[model samples]
Target chain A: MKLSKEEIAHLAKLARLDLPEEKLEKITKDFGSILEYVGRIQKVDIQGIEPFTMPAKSEGWRPDEAFEVDEATRELILANFPERAGDLLAAPGVFETPKK
Target chain B: MKPLNEITIAEARKLLDEGVATSKELTQACLTQIQSLDGALHAFLEVYADDALAAADQSDQRRTDGNVLSKLDGIPVAIKDNMLLQGKACTAGSKILQGHIAAYNSTAVRKLMEAGAVILGRTNMDEFAMGSSTEHSAYGPTKHPRDPERVPGGSSGGSAVAVAANMCLGALGSDTGGSIRQPASMCGIFGLKPTYGRVSRYGLMAMASSLDQIGPMTKCVEDAAIILDTIQGQDPSDQTTSDTEPFRISKLESRSSNDLKGLKIGLPKQAWQAGGIESRVLENTKAALAELEKAGAEMVEIDLPYADEALAVYYILMPCEVSANLARFDGMRYGLRKQGLPLFETYAQSRAEGFGDEVMRRILLGTFALSSGYIDAYYVCAKKVQALIRQAYERAFNEVDLIVTPTCPATAFRLGEKLNDPLAMYLEDVFTVSVNVAGVPAISMPCQEDGGMPVGLQLIGKWFDEATVLSAAKVLESELAKQ
Candidate 1:
């Protein structure tokens, strides 16, 4: 196998995904074959070839200006928050405090 | 008249202009079809019956005032769940964004409205447009319109089936790899994937950002042309949309020739191998090409050496982009959230419960490819190979005006056929991915039938040159229909 189960687990963590324990073995096998297939790229000699990421030529940058959000649009954005307190969007706290 | 729902956009426009049919009648006819067929087909995630009828009435009023917006005015059409329609749900077939309503219109949606097209509703799709089959949709799998046991090719499966079964006159589907064309081919309709920057991407859920494009799925090539004419233009909201020449339906309409007298269509040597293409699909595709040849188009066999590496390049680059685009789905924002202690745990737990297997698999694969220590071996290598593939197509385009291939190696498979084997599912994209890689336009038209299911013939054209592609497809479409 090209990728071990531990590697797949590590990937899931880095991707911020919480994979269930039962699905790990199957995912590892599936991911391994996909990697094996995509490994064919290594066989091609791309020594001098430049990587082509996008087709559109850069049209220069748009002006970095912020515009005012209409009230309806602002309310709509705030309304979508999963947990909100009035105008403030809420989330679980990071960096837990040690016992005093 | 043959049930108003079964009529094509061209025929409907004629009827509406002659005052023989009202927009409300057309909308109701489509709603009736959705009511009867959608339950079994699972083609629609939501149906805007009342809103559509209301829009239709407004269209009828415009006609009374002699102020029609364009040919598409009052025509009923569906949008893939991935495209936003303001104030309505836009789930993108994923539970992660399940109750999420779009605040503003997708640029395509806005253009369609501006043209007075009645918005029918949102069709289902593979979750976040990840899988080739709509079976990956968190809601449920969309069945093939003809054979309920088989899959309508996806992630635009629902939109394909909608247009195929007449749930709506036409629909919009986004193609990343083969999302739109594969499903359109399977369902026996016209699916167009315009050049990467030809259509604006604003408000559409991003899959592989560089490869994603929203195009039309319709009953005829002209209908595809008409829809493309309406939605093809640069948008201030989307920076990627190019200011290239607009798609002109008049150009498509002006072509009166039934024969492809001067058109040089290239048959890629790499696409026609014994093991690569199924015997039945090859036989059908060749037969269709023979008809085009008989009509006077020259068929040249051209070499595309790097075509074989397209799927690999697509898988790597796509996942990398997918991983980055989907990172926005943290539980802190819109959609579903599963509470947990500490910020990180909440994000992980929410995603675990929200995304389906295929989505998580892609995310994990993408994360691994882009992760440190492996980036060069996978990500950079794939991109370099992608450059080779693009260059090869550019060289071929100099020799041939278009390229022809079987949309898929085989007909639509049973629902669970390739569900478990991820690589097998990825193989379904073999012939279609290269088009996206080269950033060219392509269309899939039904060529023949294999075991009762429709087989599609793909016509590819130069970048930003959809006019030539659609005209050639129109000739072939008319000739094939005569049989």
Candidate 2:
């Protein structure tokens, strides 16, 4: 499938990447070749074959038991926040407020 | 005697046990090598001099008190930056995770620590393990150990360089589409990618969960076996890890038969094609095969009809997983953050600034592939084709005990040679990706040197059969060394 500039931009939006305009053309061209190369998979006659995501035999299943991590481990995880408030990780507000 | 750093793990173990060399001396030798060459090679992102030496001394103390943990006790090794080491910085070579400290040890690293293996440092890699060349690493590309001008193939390039240059005796590298094996081939070292689910992925920064498997890069096959034995096992945290049988090192010890008595090696018709492959690579691989044949192994010509499509399937599936796996880097928890007024913009801006060009391209490619109208054509089709490829390998294995091919089509290219061409970079993994796609174990070892560069011969083993793969690799390793 041919990916247009608009298509690439839409893809960037979907992927949460704000790509620069100058690199757009090059990326579009690069994607064209890559897509063309990867497009070969479309020719495979997968009439009855189920899509295999991963092997069925290698599954490691465990009981659904929840346990609290050690205090030291808990502290280590909390300490990695780029923007933090005491113990919670901070982030931009997700919702817009209604007009008053 | 050889430089202490250049000694193999087996040699170092002997010295340590015989009271000839102390662990401190070996660790110091590695640190000295890193200090001397890593500035030019860029192999290690950070060298843990104090920690490594301290660990070494502790191991020595244990040995003195008759409490050595395992055969790996006091051994110095490196870990690819993607694997966490508890409190150490784990960027996975991406600027996104800069200043990020791992809260807990990765299962592999934890195992290494438990075995008393001294961790030298975290080596550099492709950012988010996206690129074939380590050039995509945010820090800088690691230079080839032998030639500074060429690449040491990647995304495990730095680990390969570290092992190749003797900065570390062995290293842990994660392979998602040949990240470990290709670099090992390029650097002229032994690299193994254990069968999928053979190793736990508890703390490895996920690039493609289904395809990623952590393995060892080392000076010898025995060392690869040692590291794999220590690291491979089912872990409670990783549901994908299976309770596979151990990679019994004892099986590799008995080398009574000089000939591969009943071993059947398959040469796939697609891989042996001369057009895409370099002349020297073809020659060396053919020569290596001839040696195996002379040693009485049956050489069977096998057909893998879907072999050519493995790369296509990998590119599609890998990015789809990458886009999902890397979504956690939204500037909220831990990593580089760029503030924008709206929340959506914040996520976009932070990622856009944090990731490199290739990463962004893959993310977008993944988004497009899995996006509305195109999902059936790209994602589903690739997955179905992946099944076909897997079946082809399964059928081939019925006829042959193992499959063999050149690890890479060509020696490591000059830096920037294929850097600008994304498709060209992907082609370097053409031979190696199929093993990952099939989820089988494979090893790449130095077969011959093309001019000054080392050419790798790869052996593909059946599912959960790393023993045969390593055994074949050992035979090839010794056979090639004869020349």
Candidate 3:
């Protein structure tokens, strides 16, 4: 599995990681070996089998409201954050701003 | 003042019933042990000393009122940081949510509290439960209590180490691809991953949801059974939970070694072929089998036709689910949020800065695997292989009552040995990952030592057959104790 630098960068972008240029070679090689090891899954014959997405269960079951986080606990949770700005946490924007 | 550190939950429960030890005393003893030893072990991400003592005191009062909750009432237990405990930091050992406190109690944690177990603290884990070693934790790696230089296997490393070091009587840990069992194996304790859906996952932070199941890590198999009994059964909150009859673990004692007289144990030939398995590990595993044979269990050589593909399938399926599950942590709803930037940049930069290297790698791999063009090439095909692996286990179980293997390839490695090499680290989970794929129950128990480090033997059973698995583990545990 030969991973090009562009492929690595694309993966980094998808993962939202900031990998500097110097680390690219190392990351590429390591990921290559991992993918090589992971390549073995392709050998198994699994035709026509349904993929299990969640724990098996019957249809149409609703969960009971057993435990709820109380207001005091919610307040404590909100207060614990170091970067809150008026009920909203501020972070670097990942989307384009709306037109003014 | 009795030494609380040395007392088991069973012993403490007996004393509490007999009016010999107060829950406050027991909780204080654990707090003292944490204060004294946890600095070096780094087992706890946050300690709830005051809250724990209060809970313990309430249990004491309940006992005084002749309304005992359960046998484990008043005994303190630590929770893995990944499992939610209302009002406790639930970091999942990542910097992204370093200060995040859970808004609700996970069903397992709620059950433990209902049974009068005090929440001692939150134990560390790999970031998003992604790594084979605890070194991936943002806070730091948890050291093996047996030897500080060696890693306590992860992503449930802290829970295993705390139990091994007697910082807590028992702890709850989630196993997804050997998070519980590997660490239990490395730390010389008992850890069990119950059949998938046997325990509810209502509020557990997701990490490969299909493979994750909450279980117990304790000093002994009996304790593990007791904790399992408390947490197992139907929870409406988690529809995946079964309505299976509650297990009577105390019945295990009456089941003799002769109870296993005709039980067939399968030794998968492919397990031995996995690379990096040390000579001593194989030797100890064989010795454990010999002991099992001496106790009347028959050993059979079995072939898992597709067993070799479990790791690859796991990497694919896990990352795909992780990429989807982790999308909720977009610096919104809850968790660490970087300020002063526009929304889009904030999401990307926060994730980039928040996640560790290994976590980033998985996210990348997972994102790619799930992408439109690659879904069939990777994710869909991996699921097919996963089904094949599960079918292989089903076929093997028809001939053998249980399958046995080395819990890990080697004893505990040095702290930083495999941290930098993700492939080498992922290989450490080779023996344990298939059980997760099969959604079967498995137990990892200390069989012997490689040098001064502990080696673990894994016993895997059919789905929902934790009773047989634990029973067999108890037999092996007693045999090891005798030797």
Candidate 4:
């Protein structure tokens, strides 16, 4: 698969990374090699097999109560953050929130 | 008094039973060892000196009171930093959660505690268990005890090093891909990756949920079995854990024999393929097999039809799962947070600054694989290959009782040898990845020396059949001892 520098940058953006321009060239080359290495998996003939995500019968083994983080624990967790104001964490605004 | 650092858990338990040594003295000896060696090895991320001593005292009290917890009661065991121990910082070797203490204990940790194992400390690991070397840890790389300039094999490198250096009697490590075995091989210790779901993954910081399994890193197979016996069981917290019959270590140990008679060992045709592998590694592996044959095990050639593609499939599946599992580490919840501007920017800035290069690479690759247009093409294809890999193991098992291969392609390389080349680093796990992908149990045992470095023999077994693997390892251990 041919991936351009712009596409790599877009992927980086989606993944929330800030790759420097110099590193981008190396990353591009590395990704090309990795993709090339994994290219062989595309040829395996698994047409009739259902795509396995979770193990078989995994759904039946789900816990009775959904594991939940309680408010106090959540508050304690958030309190350890280096940058939080009130009940919310603070960050630099990049993309604006979309209107409902 | 014999030094506690030199004694294995089996020996220590015998001492404790015969009144030769008290748990308190044994625990104190381990603490001293950690004090002496940990400064250089950095094997431990945090040492619970006070708590460990106190636990040892409690176990002694239990003995006097006639209410001992179990055989492992008061035995000091180190835990990988990724496993949760309530009130201890479970950093997962990442700076983002450096100060964040776990709210709960992992099932494995909880079980160990219940069995009276003293929590010695949390060991170092690759940041979020992402690297082949512990160099990716925010704190620093754990140096191998044998050669300080070289890496201690990683992600679980710290645990292996601790066991190898005698800083801990036994340690816990999670293997997603060869994390435990690779480091154990390099460090010359026994490491096991239990069958997927054999041990619960309740509170282990998820790297690749489907692939991650908690297991033991110990000085020998018996200690590995003892630790495994305590930790392996069903847990309500982790649904993937099986409710199959509980694994009994005593039964496994008793069933083990030095005689490999009637055991058919299969050697994957791909394992001996030409190129890149050092000739010394091939020679040492062949010698180990020859010794096994002398012990009466039959060797058979079997094809792991999909073995060649395991590394590729592993990279795809691991990164994809890791990306999803690690998405929870956003700054808003519990980890590092960068202040300023807006919330979205906070997450972006925090993760961008917090994560190391290897982690960032995986997140990017995983995100790409799971992206809308590429899911079916990459992620789906990898999972299919995973099934094929598992089927290959099933087919091999029908032909032979066990499979043997080189634990790693080569012995421990110098620290910087593969640091620049990610693909080269990935290939280091070539022989070990298939066992993990197939969800079969495997153990890495030091077989011979290659250029002053340890070469490991990997014994792979059918799913959930760790006894067969450990028994074979015990036979090899005895053989190596003779040499």
Top-lDDT structure, candidate number: 1
Please identify model 3 stretches exceeding 4 Å from their true place: A23-25, A53-55, A61-70, A73-100, B257-259, B273-275, B449-451
Docking class of 4: acceptable
Deviation (Å) of A89 in candidate 2: 2.0
| TM-score, model 1 to reference | 0.98
Candidate 1 B-chain TM-score:
0.99
Q: What tier of docking accuracy does candidate 1 attain?
A: medium
Look at candidate 4 and tell me the lDDT of residue B216.
Answer: 94
How well is each residue in B1-483 modelled by candidate 2, as lDDT tens digits?
999999999999999999999999999999999999999999999989999999999999999999989989999999999999887889999999888889989999999999999999999999988877799999999999888999999999999999999999999999999999999988999999999999999999999999999999999998999999999998877878887677798888775435687999999889887368988778777888888887778998889787768999999999988888889988888888876457887788899999999998888888888888888898888888888998999999999999999999998899999988999999999999989999999999887655578888899999999988988778767777788
Clashes of each: 0, 0, 15, 8
How would you order the candidates by DockQ, starting with the best? 1, 2, 3, 4
Q: Positional deviation of B357 in candidate 3, in angstroms?
A: 0.9
lDDT of 4 by residue, B135-248 (tens): 889898899998989998888999989898888899999898899999988888889999888999999999998889999999888899999899998786788898777667
* TM-score of model 2 (CA atoms): 0.97
TM-score of every candidate relative to the true structure: 0.98, 0.97, 0.93, 0.94
Q: What is the DockQ of each candidate?
A: 0.60, 0.59, 0.46, 0.40
Error of 3 at B286 (Å): 2.1
Q: Which portions of model 4 show Cα errors greater than 4 Å?
A: A57-100, B448-451
How close to the true structure is residue B117 of candidate 4, measured as C-alpha lDDT?
A: 92
Interface RMSD of each: 2.9, 3.2, 3.8, 4.5
